[model samples]
Target chain A: MGKILGGDNMKIVMVEPINISMMKIEEYRQQLEAEGHQLIAYSSRAENDQEMIKRVKEADILIIANQPLSAKVINASKDLKMISVAFTGFDHIAMEACRENDILVSNSSGYANQAVAELAFGLVINLMRNIKDSDGAVRVGKTRKNLIGNELFGKNFGIIGFGSIGQKTAKIAAAFGCNILVDDHKQHKLGEELGVEYLPIDKLMQE
Target chain B: MGKILGGDNMKIVMVEPINISMMKIEEYRQQLEAEGHQLIAYSSRAENDQEMIKRVKEADILIIANQPLSAKVINASKDLKMISVAFTGFDHIAMEACRENDILVSNSSGYANQAVAELAFGLVINLMRNIKDSDGAVRVGKTRKNLIGNELFGKNFGIIGFGSIGQKTAKIAAAFGCNILVDDHKQHKLGEELGVEYLPIDKLMQE
Candidate 1:
């Protein structure tokens, strides 16, 4: 196992596909083989634990994306040294199995920071302006009588957490001329630079 | 008409209500009356041409929203010296009457610039991310199987008109990490400042 961990010809298996195309995966496989590592990339997720176990049996490092990796399969992967999660969340992965087998795990954090932040705006605008309702109304030749939407400009935008997603959301809100109020556990220099007002959770809720 | 224009106790009649509340209008009326100008703000729009003509019979200045101001109604306002449009668009008003009657016309332009620009984002995000469909899917216990949406983080945003609304829309787009392309009648220095590429209409459409 130690030899496999440090070996140049380690086997890497991707149990599930990421957002990339199969052609790209094949290109990656060839590139990794050229670097003395054997890459076995799966185009789809394993249907069952038995299949997952079989696929990861010879893998020194396994790549997965949102597919559930149970303790049974993880313990059965005798050569598994590390698990590379291609998603931001690793809750589906068997943490206890990794701990018991001393398997290292890495996740692609911050991969959806901007995407999620932008979605925050989308949801907010949908609520404020009644975008869904208005779109439906206009298609039916209805007037914007009761559907007069509210504006986000000159409004107080409250952010509960000051993580990467929160910071990106604050930037977009500021671009729309919103005053940002943050109630994170700790104050950040970046928040201060963005002129965000820091308040307690209670006070932020009132705002 | 010259006397009406230069009169100290000029009567201003608002034929239709703007977005402001009637209480605010009452406040404005009191303020205007204190300055030797009488402001008669109707809580609702004029029901007919007769009501409109009767309303503006004594008005030296007419303030209207989207209520149609026909040439007949405009011709009947003998004392009308100026038309103060409370809306951005004055197309509903009789522009020909204003010209024939030598009445100066003014509109509240640029009032909805930021509001319109923000709405542009709302609509774009709705279309790109399939927000409406995804929202419906989740409400019905469906997953994002075919509703995996696109992101606006790295996209080309085209602005055909580089007016106030277009400039504001460009600012928000730039904040979202989009490459902006413009095809206004003339190149704007602000577009260059924002690193927006000014292309021909056909070229911009390709982007």
Candidate 2:
């Protein structure tokens, strides 16, 4: 079996719960253990920064769900070489501290792209159609007032982020015959491929 | 050319304002008129049921956003044949009355499936990791306290309604390493193909 750092087995500790299904955890754990790594999982709240530091003091790799690791916690852990985050948003963790200590940080990306983009479209339709509000009125035995909603057939859709999620959103928007406008930090060639218009963030936001 | 029964072009009454960038109502109206149908668009609330009824009495097709059409309004329209709803949910309309009157009522169903399902997954992860709650805390300049979230790998995903929307949801859930359990009105072979276990509604709800 493969090993980390020429060791027979690597000891990895989860700093917090990774918001995923139990089966997924078991699967990942099995895969890791098969490769000669020991996985330690905890489902309790860290009592304090000190408690967290103490628990991870012996871990070779630390996997965090959403918990923030302070400079002190990183400094206290002498054996930590890698930090794998389950969530995409990494604004919580002190990256500078991890960098200073030479701890590798990895975050999950492109997993929730389809899910987040789909939800944004659903919310827009829900807001436009008042489906929930009408359902609430009917559920309470109130006289049903038909709330008029507009068709999404030909609307303008402005996407803020042109990441994987944004591209997926644009595809769905196109299927509904929407005119798409995308604003992103990086230059997007999708405008030519998907018939989307690229606009500056400030100008796009204004419209 | 196609012609209305009354010889004059048939009118299409729109109840609410719709964002029409890709497909303009005027374009549709002209196309319909070329085929010998008139289009009359409305964007005002009904002062009273009588006023609303009078406006819609001669309409061949009624286009609504979310305004509720009571049974009274349905009965008042002597020439109404079709009601095209812009949104997905049709709970606001009087389905029984429309059935009795032979007035066809159709709503957008598969349009926002991807969007809504995406949101559900996003919410699941966000709630599990306390991302939004943590972001709110950090925005106020509070010291970060990491919350533990469950890993999504190898979890049981119970899905209701195995239609296009539910199936789409199952596909995304599978990408996250979830074992899907589906509940639907009709037997679906797709569930078996996707390796999703089919269960009764009661059992699904209980789980």
Task: Identify the leading candidate in terms of TM-score.
Answer: 1
lDDT of 1 by residue, B62-86 (tens): 8888888999998998888988888
TM-score of chain A of 2: 0.80
Candidate 1, which CAPRI tier? medium
Which residue segments of model 1 deviate by more than 4 Å? A1-59, A67-76, A91-102, A140-146, A160-163, A183-189, A198-206, B1-59, B67-76, B91-102, B160-163, B183-189, B199-203
Model 1 TM-score on a 0 to 1 scale: 0.74
For all candidates in order, the CA lDDT equals 0.87, 0.74
Candidate 2 wrongly placed segments (more than 4 Å): A1-6, A20-37, A141-146, B1-207
lDDT per residue for candidate 2 within B76-107, as digits (tens), equals 88788888898888888987778877887879
- The DockQ scores of all candidates, in the order shown, are 0.60, 0.06
Candidate 1 lDDT, A97-126, residue by residue in tens: 898898989899997898898888888888
Clashing pairs in 1: none
